[model samples]
Target chain A: MGMMKHLMVRSRRRSLWMMHFCLGGCNGCSIEIMAALTPMYDLERFGILNTGNPKHTDVLLVGGSVNHRNRRTLKNLIDQIPAPRLIVAVGTCALTGGIFNEAYNIIGGANRVVDVDVYVPGCPPKPEAVIDGILSGLDKFEQ
Target chain B: MTVSVIPVGPQHPVFLEPFQLKLVVEDEVVSEALPRFGYVHRGLEALVVSKDFRQMTRVAERICGICSAIHGMTYCRAIEKLLGITPPPRAQMLRLVWSELHRMHSHLLWLGLFAEAMGFESLFMQIFRIRETVMDILEQTTGNRVIISVNVIGGVRRDLDAEGADGIRRALKKVAGDLERIRPVLVDDYSVRKRTEEKGILAKERAYELGAVGPVLRASGISQDIRRTGYGAYGELDFEPVVESGGDCQARCKVRYRELFQSMDLIRSGLDRLSDGEIQTKSKEKPEGEILVRSEQPRGEVVYYIRADGSKHLQRLRIRTPTFANMAALMDLLPGLDLADVPLVTLSLDPCIACTER
Candidate 1:
């Protein structure tokens, strides 16, 4: 168990490869996440990078509000990512379908499909907030 | 042997929004492709019929995360015209400032995504880094990074005092400098050029024939920009549309790059010309009549049609976003390309599926 914890910390520090999945939320959260990766916020300093493949990712950042059409796809993506992986629900829409909460098409929030590890709340959270959520996930992984 | 059809997205890694692409492939070469949207549709237009004008601003901005400002601005302009109340000069200037800022950020965001699609991770990171400065300016002036909730019926809601203006100027200069350094990496880099140049070629004649707008059209050598119509304070500014002749992926990339510099210049000019005045004009009376308003969003041109019935609510609001216009060009460009090139080619149009689906 002690060895496993140390390995988690090392992996968290060296590479926090994130895979972003859009459920049904607006593209706002996704853009903000992109902003965080870009120069000004530069989340790369913490070794957080967006990975294209789910199998290689250590964290999953789910944006948008989930809907009926994407439920199965979201589950498949979650299954592809290995265990001990953290799932972050970014933006108010991902948390509770946001303003679209009342819409007939929405499947509520990201949590409805997966057990989210962290919730970063905003109409679309600022880039800084997105970075903070990733860092907080690192803390959880370390424990 | 029969060809197998593989479905990509509605939830796929390459696409950021919900849209399905059904590709019938024969040994990894796409023979037929079909796209379907509306997976995330919320019937926003139907909802707008019931909401008051003020309430609809929130809905309009929600059309797409990247082009929120232009959507809200277009919606407000349509209502303002119906009421026969022009926003104060300062308000117009502020709107232009925010609009261009949004443009810079949006283009940079797309550039980063294009780079990522091409597997150039470093370039993607670099472009995004430059985008952050614009976001900082946005947050400082408008008090929100994304939604910006600044547009009201008559004008903007926030006021940028002299100090705020000076700060914005400095931010713009810094961002412009960063963009200048990164320009070579985007345009002249061997790998980037090879991947983008000559790929997704949409000839000038074809682009015009299909009615493509924004950088996609401008890349094909057409010197058309909605801003040229002088809709905001753009008429007061000295600017020219950035045009490229290639009409390929590289040409489109160049158009966005040049526009980034132009946006910086526009912001500087707007700040210099900004004057003190009422940021918003009060209009309690119902707006009556129909007016069409068009504004250039970061992606391309956005058109809003608003009809007022002398009530707090607009009778009808129709929006035609840039992505909607570019979709035709996308379908035209997609065929005859290698399967590996699909993501890069699709992104060349800078699609905002949220805007398209909305």
Candidate 2:
């Protein structure tokens, strides 16, 4: 337990690599997230970076509305990310499917697949808001 | 050796949307590639038939978050055309401003993702940092970040005054300057070039044959921009589509990179030509005809087909997103590339699976 705590703290400071999964979303949140990584927002100063491989990630930032087709994939990805992992549900779609909530195809939001640690609500959350969500997720990892 | 079929998505690290890519790989090279969509199929088209015109704007905006403004704009334009209502000049300019803002942010977001896909961590961070300014400006002006909900049937719901326009212009200038700084990183950086150049080569002939749109088409040396048709305030703006001949991942990157500057210029010009009038015209009559509205979204050309039945609700709404057109290009581009480059190349097209499946 002590070793796990120390490793968590060390990992939290070293790199908070994030892997984003789009279940079924308009790509707004995902785009805003990508915006968060660009030169304008530059989330790297805080050690936040996007990881291509889930195995290398510390957080999973899930975007879009979840649907039947992507539910299993979302679950599989959540399980793949190494533990002590934080899950951030970005955008209103990921939180509650927002405007798509009542749609027949949508399976609600990200929480339907895995446990979400933080929720950033917006049709598509702003880049700054995404940054804040990442920071808060990092804080959770530290705790 | 043995060939293995590895499934990459439906939900994967590299893809944000749910779609399955069946990669038949022999060692590190992909021999066969199959893409399966319909993961997030929300029957959006069917919903359009059920919801009233006002409620459908909400549905249209939900089609793709990155191009929500265009979706809303296109839907409104289609409805407006059907109802025979011309929005005031000021409203047109406002729509242009917001649309260009959406384009600016959308392109920046894709660039960051491209950097991330290429494994260039620092560049990704730098690009996203600059994207924040645009988002902040959007939030302040539109009152919402992702889905601004500013587009109404006849015109627009939001208005920007002189001070607001000036502030947005200043913000655009800053974004333009930031893009300039990042441009070299994407264009001249040796690593970026190494990873992107000659990778995912979509020949010009094939791009056209497959109906690729936006930067993907522009990268293939096609100068087809929906803006050229003079929709919205684009007709009034002085601009040219950015085209590149390379037809590779790098070329696609260049097209988007150049478009960032073009969008900024368009925004500045739109602001300069700002006129004062009512933002929306009163339209109590229901639309009664069919119209096809095309707009250049941040991704590419989006076609909104509306069939109204002289009622408040639309009889039918069909949206063909840029990503849907680009999907055929994806099937062609992925097969001949190394497995490692699959994600990078796929992302270069900026495939919005949600938009495609919706």
Candidate 3:
């Protein structure tokens, strides 16, 4: 147990709190994130709770694309989350700015501001894909 | 009392998308609210310079995923107007059905959010459970759930056969039955009324003068519905605007709740009127003039203005989304509201930031 605490990482893996920051693309992905949390898909069954405050979050689910206006807000959100910060970039826009990449205000995807652990690709990924993407991001805790 | 400025914005538990509202509060009561935009602004209107007119359909649909079908239909209707061609009757009927289905799902989604806004977690899940039925219908019939790419310039890309239409009918009936069981909790439940009634009252005259649209306008006793303009397949269908005169948060809730059934009725009637014909008309000529096309989206009226020069691309494309029209009304209603009431009032406007900022 050198520098990394295996017990704490294992504890965080059991109950992951996700805070979704919609960074200014069409909110299709944000809606899918909610759809994933609700009954039919029920991401909560995996001990995941959708949170609002960055302070309470373990895994940050970033939706849409990164834009000039929201970049500062995105950085502010990332700064608020404590250590062991894991981010899953959901949707094509957040991955590489997708269709809106050519637009004037878009600054590209989430990685432009902060390092994203996992990138889920879709115009707006299905709820299952979002759930899968978040689960896969848990593997990053190994480091 | 000293006033405090609280910014509820680009990311909040209550909001679905990104946008900011600066509340000027004295005590816990809000005195003024200043809105901030550009959080998710992608300059979508400017994309016409890069994307061709024929390709703008995908761009238009992306404006707001909740109302994607109607946005695409409005863009196609505007293009159809410019090209001097009308979509086939069957295409129009299918468009109406999809549009109505979008309305149902959108309302269900909103109702669930409204319940969540009130902290009614169980009700939220219950409504979303019912909403899943509508989503399945959309996916099975149109081949995708949320952003179903069905509309084209001349007509719709998909066709609904007798089997598909029958499945839709059965699904809608189940939705109605589910809704009926859930109705009492939303309608007569004491807590729902306590949180909603008289919370945000926009008088009839104020709503009209401030340019409120959709359920917000109808909730204030105005019986105006753009469907009466006979766009899409509405001309062949018989329906009346669902109006409520309470002019409060509860009134807006009731308006949308009633509309869920109204949309089911509209879809049923459109299915009855579905005739055998081609979905699209062949038009080789490019559009060459200015035209304005309007349609009733789930949120409200969406207007698409297109100017073409007989070339492959358009000269200009402008959209006036309903949320834009409702902003002034929201500003007017927000002052003198309690901090706790802000979420309910804002949700009453059905603020679609993607549509507004785009």
> What tens digits encode model 2's per-residue C-alpha lDDT throughout B122-200?
8877777787788788889989877788899889998897778888988988887888877777899888789989998
Ranking by TM-score: 3, 1, 2
Locate the minimum summed-lDDT window of 10 residues in model 3 chain B.
Answer: B292-301
DockQ result, candidate 2? 0.54
Candidate 3 lDDT, tens digit per residue, B29-106? 999899999887998888888988888999999998899999999998998888889999999999999999998989
Give per-residue CA lDDT, model 3, range A59-138, as digits (tens).
Answer: 99998888888999999999999988799999988999877888888889999999999999987899999999988888
Candidate 3 residue runs with Cα over 4 Å from true position: A1-6
What lDDT score is found at residue A60 in candidate 3? 93
Instruction: Give the whole-model CA lDDT for all candidates, comma-separated.
Output: 0.84, 0.83, 0.91
TM-scores, all candidates, are 0.92, 0.89, 0.98
DockQ of each: 0.51, 0.54, 0.80
TM-score of 3: 0.98
Clashes of each: 8, 22, 1
TM-score of chain A of each: 0.92, 0.90, 0.93
Could you tell me which 10 consecutive residues in candidate 2 chain A have the lowest summed lDDT? A31-40
Candidate of highest DockQ: 3
